[model samples]
Target chain A: MGEPLLRVENVVKRFGGFQALGGVSLEVQPGERFGLIGPNGSGKTTLINCISGTLRNDEGRIFFRGQDITALPAHRRTWRGIARTFQIPRPFGTMTVLENLRVTLEYAARERARAGDPAVEAMEILAGVGLDPKAGAISGLLTQIEMRKLELARAMAAKPALLISDEAMAGLSSSEVDELLEILLRLNAAGTTVIMIEHIMRAVMRFSERIAVLDAGEKIAEGPPDKVVSDRAVERAYLGE
Target chain B: MQARWLLALAGVLIVGAFVVTRTVDNRYVYFAAYGILQYVLLATAWNILGGYTGYVNFGTGAFFALGAYTSVFLIQAVQAPLVVLIVAGGLVSGLLGFGIGYLTLRLRGVFFSIATLALAVVLETMMVNWEYVGGAKGISIIRPSAGPLFTNYVQLLFVVMAALAMGAVAVAWFIEHSRIGRGFATIRDNEEAAECMGVPTLRLKLLATTVSGCLMGIAGAPFPYYITFVEPVSAFNLSYAVNSLAMPMVGGTTSWVGPIIGAVLLGTLQQLATVTISSELNLLIVGVVLVAFVVLAPEGILGLLRRGTRRTRA
Candidate 1:
């Protein structure tokens, strides 16, 4: 699939004597809807954090867009078109919704200064996220779903080609999950590769093009969503079958 | 458009104040204005890092002392122009800021502030023992001529201080409206979120610290000439820290104009107290004002003004 957009090769991460991620490896293709799932303490977040440069891998290489990005700083990785939403939406509480988007827009502008008007680009992003109406509202006062949307909007503001959404629908209801899934589908349709790390089984089954299950920092199964869900190893890992 | 009009009104008022000071022959008025100007610059500088970036700096006295001593050394060594010495002082302080920030920007709030305070104490001790700078006895600067066109150097110094204050305010305003300002706000609010969103928080914090230190240095650089003496006691005085810290806290730590307003009101009151009441009473009043604002009007006078304006508009 056009030389995988992201590749993690034998990545290892440790916290003193405890190994958070032990030689984990994964690849995400361009425009792919990849699902990352595992039980709690399965190193799902640790693997993503290492991929996103939030934590450096103890060993192994991370290649992004055909280049070694192993040692690149988190912001530099973002500039290279990698953006992630937090597990907990952390909007700049003091700023308005529009201003929160504006900060990301400004970072993108600084990186690509020669690329036309920044304010117009910022507004376009807000519109895309369906947050144009509440643009001037204080971010701290936003409702739960609105905050999730803002988290996505901020990730998209950098105009990243690859978007990592970490539990965007964590605390939402079933209907809210569908709403967020629709937004992610729309974003993916516009050619942004998305890696959705979610624990919701039905949503992940519906959204992921390819699913990978991690059990205790190891990839126990990888295949089509239907097959992966039906795999004995996956069932045993989740339900202790 | 509304903001622009407010800025224009501010500009007019500032120019009018300068004109009145220029025309008036009253020394007391100039002295009061000069003192306010110093506090305004110091508080504004402190606000760059403390308010905008959400990094409270307790080392205001260190940068101030650095500028004062740099001015003294340059004047004593090369007899340079006051303007040049001021710039030199600012550059030296900026470099020091860069060095300190590079070493300590990884630290979170209180730890960073404590490191800076430690740096200040260490620097103060070094200056106190260093004999070339009069070894705590202090060095008296001979006031250089301001040319025949202007005879009253105090008035000239007042004008210079006022100009510097205006420049500091202008820079703060520009930063507040710019992208860097927004980035700083994000860093202050949620640093991890900011980094994930592609903000280079470390670099931005360092930039704020450097610029803040430079401005503080420039504010202090003229003190030896303005007061015509420089001693460790006055240069590295804890009062500098108290004034810098209190002014921003009383003004509202959220906006550009907060510190400027706080500095002027508090500074004018202090000067008046020093003249009419005991010198110690001035600090006592500042302490009282600071506590009152912290407890009751935490948003400060400028915050109240902003709220009042918003309420009126609504």
Candidate 2:
């Protein structure tokens, strides 16, 4: 009912001749668990990149809590409380895992984190993502799941009102997926809005209150998880009926 | 280390330099030490941008020469004091660094290195044609009288250089331990990720260039007085470019201590080679030592020492 936490209004992105994102639009509410799913090359990543200010959309405007941020640079967008995990983990290789979170805490969350010492706050974030024991480990040498957890923890260090998880569960074991899902669930319950772009159907169906499906850069279906799964177009888009 | 401890260490070093000036009567010793100390300042300046931020600037000589030239101009026009010359030189080169960074930082990797190389060539050409600060033929400077503090002008220069080198190192140490240093590390490791994490990579890179350039320029501000001649060719010597970069690589790129070690070791070696062999062999020494370090310890002497200590502890 109130202004959506994030609104994407008909974004178009073209890489030379090919349109990576073709006029896609979506909205996510405050404290909502939203899922965005598409087959490979359905423009899910492109759309998110546009929303996160990594790739500027050609035609659309983006709003975060009623502020137009479509023209902002990626770092400025981050300063405005939008944090994202890379689809492929991009841990700061030379720094310790704890230092990685410190980067975000010192920069993105500096204004909000006025009371706590950055090291103490960084350790608290690492603990929340279950990476406290590896706090001193070099981030580049972390195991895949640990890197993913570090990525999430680093994102959480921003204290973002909106957290974008992009294929964070990819290449992760099921138990790892469950663990990450639990973290996401807990984060959402504690008043953070989450946009999960995942390929894992079971995780999506279980976690999302509502889901939006993208097919070839278009939103094919969006509704409550059960209704969206049973929709004929959603089935066709996944199974090629 | 805490800033206070670092300041105290600097105080000790300055006192030691003053003692050497008092005790040693040999002028050549001051000459040789001044050369070595200049390298310490230059290499430390280079590492602030090159090592900390992963931006390789091949235009080290350009900034150094600019500072020297700034002094040359001021000396001819206003007969400014050494302090004023140093400040003016730093401001000029700092502005140039910010301008160049704005234009060229958009190009990453080898392209950025090439652009910096081009910058040295461009600056050299300008200096060669500029008549006010002496053209390609060069100009001689009459040495200023040494004040009550020292025995002669060269001794005064030696002490001044030692102070400058210590100040440069103290500044580098401060940056290495601060939030700016952490931001720089992220930019080095992964820039895009750094930006997404809100590190403000572009602004930080500009800050790096300005600070690095200002220090290099400050090191150069005394050169007109030190050498008593200002010329394009010698002022933009190829050895300065090579030594500033090589010293950091040989010492270690990660911390401020590495450049000082590299500069002192390599510089002393080169000074010895110049005395024992020929001055022409200075580059050859740098070449041989750099190759050895790159192959045996690519992380520099500090990295090797760190590995050594870790192994011993284990």
Candidate 3:
């Protein structure tokens, strides 16, 4: 717990003439519940893309558990125990919900898959995410909320040490958001470190033990939610005042 | 779905086909059989990348022609046996597939497809200019002595083609049920999500392309000997491209059975249409049938059949 679970130092990412992220540095402690809140187009997703290896950073180093992982591919980062959810749910429409979970479990827990039944384990994960009843249902047939649950279940199946949840509550009703928040909290309580990226202020403020705010490709504030809520810079960044 | 069951079924079908062909004792039957089975092989090979992994390979004709020409070159050089020629041809096409996939797989969607289509044109032009294998004038290979396994060359070739088609089906089935197939499914579903979930998408895509190309190339290996001549235009005909793509799309793309069903159904229909009516009408029939399938059942026959069962249950 003394060492950072993930470390990003001076990340700079650009697409052609536009700079998406500029010299952002951050550290996530092991077993920490961290929140990242940002306005639209504020480099939150880009920073995540660097950490997750979706896009390479033009400058900077990213480390996971003291190992330099800036150059690793996305699948390698996942194998190294970093799993992320997408902002938009992307379940395989042709497969059943259980099959979607099996893909992750089969790949990530390859050693476990050698000994145990992936179908049984996939059902267990579906049950965990409260999608057990829809295990056999085609993924495309799922409701919006169910799709989100399947996405989380798929991530959970990877058995990551650090879970980066990207807008898991997007487009959900308040009750659905609470349900998702509870699941995330329960998961964090069970020992997975969480870095939640969200636009939902209420969810972020309530879920975070420590929060970081991003505005226009810069970190505007870093502290507890209440402190960040009162910070002048954070207020000005959010309100553009 | 199971290996043992599939193996057993293949054994029965191979033996059954042999008995039926022998009983027919007609050259036209063997010729028709070979023509139809060729598509069975091509469609199965194309399905590996197209139906399963969802990568459009517009250069199947090039790969097929490459395989045939590889054999022509080998035959001209030392008169290599059909078996050796097939292996050499597959190796050449597999390497080409891998090379082209490496260059273009980075580009997604229509761009990648256009690259493959370009590959076909480039390769065909090279074949046209390169006079070693007679160039555009084409070359003919006299039939070689037959092995002890069969009484006649054509009969032996038919048996070999049948075996290859069955083997291709088996390979596709094995991939469909294995971990590799699941990885391919993930790629087909969503490449980005699959990558973040720990699936190595690029590696799997490369594998599918190589294997698919190799098999398509192998199917073309025996074609020159069967036709006794090879021309650049005929070898690289767009019919190979059209039929291979349409067969799997019309039959189904998601499972091993789809390509076989599509190839057999469409191939047999085309053969009959060619015999009974104008040969040029075959292409129109394929186009119309493909358009109908795309409009009515984009998932193909397997999907359409599943819908039928769903209605009964409801």
The candidate that wins on lDDT is: 2
On residues B158-265, what C-alpha lDDT tens digit does candidate 2 reach at each position? Answer: 988999999999889989989999899999999888888888888999999999999999999999999999999999997888999999999999999999999999
Task: Note the chain A TM-score of all models in turn.
Answer: 0.95, 0.98, 0.96
lDDT of 2 at A210: 88
Candidate 2 global lDDT: 0.91
Arrange candidates by lDDT, descending.
2, 3, 1
Query: Which clashing pairs does model 1 show?
Result: none
Between prediction 2 and prediction 3, which has the larger DockQ?
A: 3
True contacts kept of 3: 0.83
lDDT of 1 by residue, A51-117 (tens): 8888899999999998999998888899988999888889999898888877887784356542566
Candidate 2 residues A1-241, lDDT tens each? Answer: 8889999999999999998888888899999999999899999989888877778899989999999999998888888889999999999998999999987889988655444788998998788889999999989999999999999999998888899999999988899999999999999999999999999989999999989999988999999999999999988999997
DockQ for each model: 0.72, 0.79, 0.84
- Candidate 2 wrongly placed segments (more than 4 Å): A113-115
Residue pairs of candidate 3 with colliding backbone atoms: none
Stretch of 10 with least lDDT, candidate 2 chain A: A108-117
* Steric clash pairs (candidate 2): none
Write down the TM-score of every candidate: 0.95, 0.97, 0.98
Count clashing residue pairs in model 1.
0
User: On residues B226-289, what C-alpha lDDT tens digit does candidate 3 reach at each position?
Assistant: 8888999989998898999999999999988898899999999999999999788888988999
